[model samples]
Target: MSERIKKELALYKLREIEIDDMKLKVEELKIGEQLGAMNYEEKVQSSMNCKNNDYVMNEIETLEKRIRFNEIANKRIDNALKRLDIDEAEIVRRVFIEKKSITLTAQELFKSRKSIKKSIDRAFEKLKLA
Candidate 1:
């Protein structure tokens, strides 16, 4: 690839990694919340000891901020995809926008499951560049 193209690709990949990391962080937060709830139920006071309570509150705040930022980045990617004029945009729309599964989206888009997945990945890369 040309230097410019390579740079764009790198940017796209970085954005994708950011999105994926944010999603993982959200999952971690949910797991933390569940565990916290369980712990609190067993012993509310123990779970909220001064230091632990501060730590947990800080963690939740950070997670919420990360989730919000990720959501904004997701919207930016979506807008970028819309501008790319990619024919598979509808497939993306159904899968990401409508939040459908790969199998169902493949059926809707008349593509094989693997193709659908590749399309999604490429779409992410395509939109990652500013």
Candidate 2:
């Protein structure tokens, strides 16, 4: 179960990158459209631009679908965390969601490293049962 949670966290991070890339592509397409409008051969260039815009629009739609799926997956993770006790949930959130190291989490939470590790281990045990 802990492994599954880790995998899901990794997937969530990858999806975030994918979504950012998609947004960048959309911006690039907009720039391309502006350049196409400035072309001296207006008729031919405009026709090509229209086709390109249609393709870009379709790609954006597909990207949006993937982003929505990822968002749903993240929401499910949040809901699962809610099932854990507050301290356990905080440990899980710091280590997994915030992507912090055990030492960093302990420092941030003002707890000893051993205590943090114990909380994390207990959190995983509860998450497994959950």
- Which candidate's TM-score is highest? 2
* TM-scores for candidates 1 onward, in order: 0.39, 0.71
Q: How would you encode candidate 1's per-residue C-alpha lDDT over 23-89 as one tens digit per residue? A: 6876776687666654545545554454565676677678668667766766665666676546567
lDDT of 2 by residue, 3-117 (tens): 8977886576676777778778777766776766545555346576557766866876777787688778878878878888898888888788778999999898899999998
How many pairs of residues collide in model 1? 0
Candidate with top lDDT is 2
Model 1 lDDT, residue 73, Cα:
65
Regions of model 2 farther than 4 Å from truth: 27-50
Which ranges of candidate 1 are over 4 A from the true structure?
Answer: 1-12, 29-48, 87-130
Each prediction's whole-model lDDT (CA): 0.63, 0.77
TM-score of 2: 0.71
